[model samples]
Target: MTPHELYADLTRSGLNLIGQALSIFDADLRLAVANRQYQAMFDLPAELTHPGTRFEDTIRFLVMRGEYGPQDDPEAAVAFRVEQARTFQPHYFERERANGCCIAVEGAPLAQGGWITVYTDITDIKRQESLLRARSEELSGQVLDHAERLAAANRELAATNAALQEAQRILTRTEARTRQVTEMVPAHIAHVDGEYRYTFSNRRLPSIFPGAAGNVIGMTVEQALGAPTFDAIRPWLECALSGEAQVFEITHPTSGRRIRIALTPDSASHGVYILSTDVSAEVQAREALSHASKRSLAAQLTSGMAHDFGNLLTIILGLQGRLAALDLPGHAAQDVQATLAAARRGATLLDRLARISGPREMALQPVDLARLLRDVATLARPSLAEGTVLDLAIDLPDGQVLLDAGALQDSLLNLILNANAAIAGPGVIALEARFSGEWIELTVTDTGPGFTPEALARAAEPFFTTKKGQGSGLGLSMVYDQTKLVGGTMRLDNTPRGGRVRLRLPLRPIARQMILLVEDDDSVRMQVRGQLTDLGHAVLEAGSLAEACAMTDLPGLTMMLSDIQLGDGLGVDLDASLPMVLMTSLPPGDPLRARAQGPVLTKPFTQARLAAALAEAGKRT
Candidate 1:
């Protein structure tokens, strides 16, 4: 027999072992389960005792047999009983059957519809009562009668108590199930009363907002969420309490995460329901998309104008070159040279403008930040005045983080050059790098005259330079653009010591290790090997899964990057100790692709995308 059938048989046998009769019916009024005692007590036929027998049919049979002591109309009596069963409620009663046997009936409604009924025979107790009334000379007639009535009442109360206990059990299970569902959700689900005190919570506050109290059942909103977060949403809370629903977003001051909160008014009480979710990733993605759209529009508007302007600059340069080649008078030659210089400066300005409005993508890769910063200082020192000193202070955990090294290098160089110009002589230029939670912060400070109010407000705006005719003013603007494209932030401020420019970028650290590359195609394998080499990782190539598996025991092997479909076997069947990333050309819905145990990359991908996939694999490991 199947396990399910065996379990059912065991359950039936146990139910039949009970002395009392028990039966269950479904919402459709069909018999679901009945103990052997139930069938024997009613003398029911085989068909009537089976599952799916209608309760109405059973009632009609019993009524026709005079089980209720000869009802005037059997059909009418059956109809009445069936209707009462349809609206069944918890009940207890005692009745004497036509056979003169007494039984106590207890029925309780089920949570998922239908009801359970238990019948206990009380014939022996009834006989004891009759004997006491007929033969006991020590007891008065009135006292004996009162005693019999009290015994029947006590039995009814006992049956009622059993039904009440069953109802409590069902309620407890329901409450536990509801709590489980709410806790499993990825957000905070809570309710607050009119006093702004929390009444119920799923204990998920800490998961959504780091450092939040796990349980806030009796705490006020301000106390639970902190003063700053509470103040930010206080107006919305008031509106919700006044029967108006609200949905809004805010940045948590402590964790720097974006939170989306929805408050719904409870119509039946002076309270509000709350749902809070962490939407930091969503907000970052949306901002990145918005910046990309703006860049596309700028490129379209400037591409044509830039083309025409470039042609004009070329003509001017060519004519000026021809003039300089001629044997002209000395004074006239000097004037010509001056004119050429101005025209050349205009060409340079056009180049900077093109860079500002051009389409570019962040090529993120693992970079040694300390090494990058040292290189920046080495390059900037030669440009600084003789008295100027470049100082570097880096306080960060030991690791390489994902960054666009070239872009960051250019931005830092520009800031250092700008700071050098700001200082007259003998000033300290300090570069500091540190960690702030999931972000890497870099700050450049100079001991020069701090920025004026206007410069502080517009330093990052295009063509808003402090240098009158010497600066192109696109340096800070380009730096700001690059930072925003990668969901980073740039801030300009004036400190007591000097002017400061701070940049904060997401810190995604990835470890460099030897990797196994598995692919059936030689050309693809070679191409991927070159990409890995460029990212500073040693790669070992294999033509199939069997070859890859043979090298799994190699020393210093840290991870694997493999194609899903291999000649001998699938890459997912590899050992799970080493982190893995899979690449495939299979359609998204393909079963093999869906079976990928780690991060999956599409077949045609760039070095940046591969770096990202490897980083994700590292996180999973």
Candidate 2:
């Protein structure tokens, strides 16, 4: 037999063994189940005792047999009982039937719209009362009255028992369901007493805090969460106990996860409720946005000043150049050369500042990391001091990753120069690249004195440099900014020999594909066409949207790169289904420029910018 069938059979057998007669009816006023005792007690026929029998029919049969006492009209009595059963309530009473048997009947409602009635025989008790009244003439009327009241009390007790059973059943189900819900939740839900002892938990503490034990109930806070974590949140727990609700975040030392916790005081319960959720991703995003916002504000503040500074430097360099061109004395010539060199350095610093404070966005495109790293190594060699030895350790899979090759090269070169400068003389710099989980980790380690504690902390900040007047300090800041703009991260720390700077970039791999190029201007179109060709893409050119639309149906068409302002019409109006990147020279605030659909690329963009736009378009499509 099936498990359900066996369980039903067992339940029925067990019910039949009970001394009390029991029957259950469905909401439809149809008999659902009855124990054998129920049938025997009522003397019901096979038809009336069987499942699916109408409850009204059983009542009618019983009424006819005077089960509920004699009635003048039995049909009317059956109708009344059926209607009362339809609106069933908790009821208990005793009645002497025509067969001269006294029984107590108790009924309780079910959750899914039904009722169960239990019948307990009380005939012997009733007979004892009659005997007591007839034989005990010496007994007072008060004693006889008390004896009669005993049956009612017994009925009340049976009703109370049934109510308690129903209540207990509901409570058990509710608790089970509540725990199930809390267990399924992503956050940890727990309760702790004022003494900092865990009273209850959903066994999710270990999941949220990697080192915590799952069964932490009855354990002290210290035993559950180790000293480091407990110390961090103990103050908040104290605040919660003082009838305050607080929310905070902490970094898990073991797992390095950012956890957001909320604690609320339970005044009546004399404990605190805790909720904790892993919010590492959220915290990272928030930090990135905050950094970006600060950069934007700094950019706005410095743009005008940098402009004037550039103008002043240019004038000085020009005047100094004019003076140096003419024949002069040795000391005068040396002075002019020094002034020109200082102006050039100032100009370089200004350029670095603009880079850090500018509205720079990464142009993520499919880039061959091996080739990029090799080129950066070669480009950085010229900048390193003569005694400095630069070494490259490139270890990466053979694939083009979605990245901004130009920005990446700049950041790496900046690090190489910084490392070269850190080592006063005759030191080696090593660069390594490899994939670490979801991130492409690029590390630059230099054999130098390493960063001072203050430099290590404030290195990413703008204009915080150890090179004094020789360094702009904006180099690392620019690298940090670019890393964050692409949703990546940069870390600076000291190694035993020297400092190590690592950039963690998400590994987004993309394959190079054919691109359909659309632009009206012959020179601009051809220039971009060459750029795309250099990026390992075969480009098909069209001067107008009409031509581009026709070429879109060309077999093997992968994507479209077009100017927002086309010769025939706007490129955004093209009926092409391919992923598109629109190029525009219009000002940023122009409504017409902003209306181009898909990822927009501003005109006067580099090859790297175009590729990044394509990568973004590829992502959306």
Candidate 3:
């Protein structure tokens, strides 16, 4: 038999037995043939369908739903199916119905001219394929999701690493700052191990010893320092090893100098931190001060005794004056008057001696620095050598200070006289005063050859002098001692042009004498008020010149004591006869100096002198 005849017979027999559906069609839309399986499945009565039936119509009849396309484009699916079959040579397709009918359609080319299309009712197989496709899509989505999660985890890890690096950088910067602070510290610092090995030391440690330049780490203290100092430090080292800290002083052998040393325990290595400081200069200064203090005490004792003796002489002189007034025998009375005169001269000598010693009992009172400055200028004029002239430029505040009047006046005279003697030719002697907080400061500047270094060093030392024949060497020393007694400080130095002495003494904040004190600096006004109260004077307080001026019209206001640099303006309009004293913290050359009508006083005057000046003013008024 022929191959085509055999295939046709086998196809027919297989379709009948397996209830399979089969179809054959040309490229044109026509029903070529249908197998028995196809007829049995759709319940067709005829083996062959009507001629000229479109392929799309047959496909729509087989498929209840429009799975392919609209009825208007029925030929569109036919063209697509043909093209698919041609491209793949053969293809398998399945269609499913909503009511559970599943069909697999397979098209393959026949050896004859046309092709055969077979439709098999594989409902279960097609259903399984669809379920498997959905599961595969779900698995693919899970893979994509997992990939995104992994990418996000990678980004988080990178950010964490970056943050860690940033933290490490901050820690490094903090450590660097800490190291710089440690190195720049002024004190000596060092660390040593149990075996006396030097662990660490700051930059200043080497400067203190001058011997440690090379690396000091790992060298025992004894090996590095060689002997006694190392032995002396052994106990301190042992204390640190025993977990205890120690602080002590010892003399170093190399420099043979006393040093203060401290040891602290280091927990990391059980070592010790050694800190040593040089106190040699401080020790010497303390000893010198102690000696000078002793001398001053002795001088004070002598002065006290001499002062008592002077009081007794005063009584004797007073009695003699009365005795001389009495009319008596001429010879006897003359002899008694001579004895009294001699006793009075002796009393004057005692007073001079007491001045030489540092006088103990002093009547400290608020003194007008301006008046004292004027008096010193007057006293120094007569002492100026042949061609020399003394000049005084003063800005004295009516402000009073608490001080020993006689001693301060004497000190001022000495300074002025010294200045006059220093200059060989005519020279200007400038005296200036100003308020400094609670103290009044006076500067006496002289245009003359400056003091030599030797003289400057020994200026306040007793019995030390540059003047060969004329100086007793006790003038400045007495000044210094007196200043100390009054709780003041005096500095002698060479100015740009000549020699100068600056004296600072605490002043009473307020003056109670029939005057009003006005100042912008509240502390200064308060201090001046306190000084006035101390001197038994009543001081009216105002914060500014305007306030004081306003009080001028007010009842019971006596005198205006206002600062030149007042809140409103300079106190230049103060009543001239009302005893207006311009108070200032500025020096003499200050413009306010010329504007003030009454006497000006710098800040920081002693109590007694201020009261005397005020008393004199009151008497004049």
Rank all candidate structures by their lDDT, best first, as comma-separated numbers.
Answer: 1, 2, 3
Tell me the tens digit of each residue's lDDT in model 2 across 300-418. 87887987888899999999999999999999999999999999988887776676665665676678898999999988988888889888898898988878888899899989989
Off by over 4 Å in 2: 1-276, 289-297, 512-621
Candidate 3 regions with alpha-carbon error over 4 angstroms: 1-291, 294-362, 436-438, 511-534, 538-621
Candidate order, TM-score descending: 1, 2, 3
Say which prediction, candidate 1 or candidate 2, comes out ahead on TM-score. 1
- Which stretch of 10 consecutive residues in model 2 shows the poorest summed lDDT? 356-365
Listing every candidate in turn, what is its Cα RMSD in Å to the true structure after a full C-alpha superposition?
4.8, 11.7, 31.9
Candidate 2 residue 51 Cα shift, in angstroms, is 25
List lDDT for all candidates, in order: 0.89, 0.85, 0.68
List model 1 lDDT by residue over 1-621, tens digit each: 999999999999999999999999999999999999999998999899899999999999999888987788888999999999999788888889999899889898888889999999999998998888889988999999899888878877887887778889988998999999999999999999998899999999988877788889999988888998888989999999899999999878667688999999997889999999999889867755665565566567668798888899899889989999999999989988998998999899888888888767779888889999999999999999889999999998777888999999999999999999999799999999998877888999999998999987777666778898889878887888888766687777888999999888877787787999999999999999999998889999899888999998899999999999888889988877899999999878889888888889988998888988898788887
Report the candidate with higher TM-score, 2 versus 3.
2
lDDT of 3 by residue, 1-621 (tens): 999999978976875676667776665645666667766766543523554556555555543345443455656665665455444245454556455687666665543335566666767654564575566765676675576456445544554454456557767888788768877875677788777788886656555554644456677777765677778878778987788888887655454345778888987887889887876556545644863675676577666687577778888888888888899799979987897978877776565445655336456765666787778778778878776666666655556555677888888887877787787678888777777554568778888998899987678876676778666566777777677666566677897899988887655454455677778898888877776777776677778666776777666666666777777777776556576666666788787788766666766654454554454445444
Better of 1 and 3 by lDDT: 1
